[model samples]
Target chain A: MPFTGKVLVCEEKVHLRRLLSLIVKSLGQHVLFEAADGEETLLLYQSVKPDLVLLDVNMRQRDGIQTIQALKQIDPDCLVVILTSLVNHLTAEECLRLGAADCLRKDLPREEIAVQLARIIDACFGDIPA
Target chain B: MNVSDQPSPMDLKGRKILVVDDDRLNTRIIRGILRPQGYEVADADSGEAALAAYPQFLPDLVLLDVVLPGLNGFETCRRFKSLYGDACAPIIFITARSESEDVVEGLAAGGVDYLPKPFRAKEALARIRTHLQNRLLLEQLSKANAAKNRLLGMAAHDLRNPLASIRGLTEFLRDGTVGPLSTDQLDLVNNIHDASQSMLELVNELLDVSVIEAGELKINRAPVSLTALIEKAVYLNNINATQKHTRIVLQTCDLPQPYLVDAQKIKQVLDNLLSNAVKFSPSGSTITVRMEAGANGCSVSVRDQGPGIPKDEQHKLFKDFGRTSVRPTGGEKSTGLGLAICRKIMEAHRGTISAANHPDGGCEFQITLPS
Candidate 1:
């Protein structure tokens, strides 16, 4: 069994989006919306109201932190996971404080998806079956 | 006391001179020697007076006597050193301190050269010329170091982002979240992932060292939230933390305020601190991370329950290639670059990082960055 909730995937890079969408589909989770950058992330959030968001930290127009802050401000319950390759402790802490659901390094194995998704879903939206 | 009376070794046609000595005779003698060279001269008989006149006079050189009535010559020289660092005009000690020991002391106290008792005015002029030339060379070296540091920082930054992107892609593919991955395939991915991460760390350290060399490296300054940074750092490093069965204690201040800092750089500093804490601590011991505000800045401290840093070796901890003889608990290969990078990053933000054995019998790494 996999996650059934609607998930909005936002990443600046194109290959990442395709890969992320594939992962969500494989996990039995719905890819309710997709965004290439921060601007699109925000716009999609309005129309899709995704139960989850996978956000790339560095993006054009608005950065990951600003986008997360804005989305949280709008919904107050937005589940946003910061996806960054350069995992500086200071930035990870900042994203969490700014109301990000979690901060995930982009380098984990595909097999570890369920474990990570479970942890984030539990951390942000409370312990519930995804 | 005319412009042509003194020896002309001093090319003071455009230079300024400050005469600092409590003795009326010494002031008069300095004036007699320098005035004739067309040098602008200002006299301050007291340390207090010298400080008051220094900025106003903007002298090209200072003739300080070692035995002043108050705030003696050594103290005056030290204050002046602080005022201008290595960039200011040379302070030549034209004093009556004739002992070899006294001469050494004067030079150590910031005097570029010591003209002992019964000094010829002509010789003093020659010594001043040499000091001025040396000072100019020292200033140029400092400028060069600053420029070098900036270039190093730029190189580090440029190399890091692409490495991160590559690491991210590797991570995305390895996780098997996009599809399914076999156990053997996953193991291979893990190895690749770890190697890339290690390379990433090395690249960061290289950048940090470059910044330190140039002395122009500083932490990015902005309003930062500590709680978020801490959680993220701890989480990222949790695997290592778990291997040691170490627990992390995070204590936020009563009124946690937003600190001004470049968040990414500070996080690197914090990660290094935490990594060191976990590395050195005994298994099952607790590592406490606390954030508090002080008179000058906000401080984050990582206290580890491990063998403390020996006092003798503490001074060299931040030096390039300076590593403690004590090895990591699990025989973890230390790049020996962590603390050096930590110090450089902290300094870039006008902050400081220091380590000490905690009173409770462990090691503590404390970082203070201005708010």
Candidate 2:
């Protein structure tokens, strides 16, 4: 069965946001939303209440960590997967400890990223929960 | 470069030479030989005097006599060694003790060479000149090497962000995420994309090397499954395999025990080898990944069906910027620093990585981690 859910991608770069939107669409009949920074992401999270969030770590104003904290405060059940090029493992782990769904490497080849996202979608929306 | 024949006297002008001799006659004679050659000479009547004069004179070289009035030459030499540490200026012992035993003792005491007593002026001058020249050259080379590393680190770091942006934008163009194009336009965009990706990989690898060399390579070891790591590496590498129309086969023996490793770094090493196999092999070939368990340790090997590395160039494969005669089958580019980084990461894990020609054909790269 094709996985379906709402995904909100928060990235500072417009191109990355657009690309991630495209990948999320290619996955299934999932509704998609995009945010440029943490503040915008939280405002959208309040209104949209998307089933999934694709967060970037390094951002202006508030970062992924802060945004995730705010999102959890709103709804602890919120599913978020980090999509970043962050080389620092410690930061990634900190996000995980704050209840992140998973962390994906942005530096990977496009197909590999798509495959990983697909796997996450299966686990998140299918029989298995991530 | 004969010690006696080469350095012009002017080259070492004003180089300080401390004469640590109790005899005033011997000090004067040595000064007469060195001063005419443009050397600045300072004399100490005894070992204690020489140690006291050291800080003020800051001599480039020291000439000590073994048969001193109080402190022995060997003892003084040892003291000098302790003061300067590794880059201590050359210490030549001017002593009557010319026995093989004395020469060994002098060297063992950190003396550079022995200028036996009753020495000819020419021999003393030659020895002094050679050592001084060597010291100056070593200092210069070390300075240059450090400067080069600093430059490399900065340049690589500066180039990375912009290069990543270019790669991302070009990838968007190639994927038609931005817009579609004609065949020729698509080819141009694809070429640009590939080039940017190659440069991005090179820059990233250089950054990894510099960061590790800065002594910041912290290996966070955990009980990781090597078999699972290899499986993921294959899954990721298969994207390249699909692009090249090659098949990747994975074989494994059950490794139930948890093997300690930094999962991310080991994955990097495996990825490099698997991608290399993809890069060098023919389009319609097969790549094999195997994980084995041994009594001493566990091992992972990646074998490619490409032209085996030539015996002569095999030695160059793992060295920094090392390249071989074979070219990538698909015109794929290598960072050249990939294997070098892989070797470094393995070394951190107390593991070893090696490459060899497989008996069937092509080359195989294997890494072993001690259990």
Candidate with the greatest DockQ versus the true structure:
2
Candidate 2 CAPRI-style tier:
incorrect
List chain B TM-scores, each candidate. Answer: 0.63, 0.71
Q: Which run of 10 residues does model 2 chain B get worst, by summed lDDT?
A: B1-10
Give a tens-digit lDDT track for model 1, residues A1-130.
4356788889887766665666566556465678998989899899878889999887777988888889988899777888865335476678888988677765444446446766676565564657
Query: Which digits, one per residue and each the tens of the lDDT, describe model 2 over residues B1-371?
Result: 47995434437888888999988888888988899999999999888888889889988899988878778889888888898777677889886744668788889999998887776999889999998888877777677766766677788866765566566667777778668988999899888887878887888888787777666678999999788788888999999898999978999898866889999999999989998999998978999988888888989898988999999998888887887779998987776788988998999999999999999999899999999
lDDT of 1 by residue, B1-371 (tens): 46785334534465777888887887787778777767678899888788789888887788887877878888898999999886567887766644677678888998878887665889877787676556555555677777766776777766665555556566776766457788888888788877767777777787768755766465567777877887789777767888888878788774356777789888888888888888887888898888888777778888988899888998878887688888888776577787887787787777899888879799888998775
Cα lDDT listed for each candidate: 0.76, 0.84
Tell me what TM-score chain B of candidate 1 gets against the true chain B.
0.63
TM-score of each: 0.54, 0.61
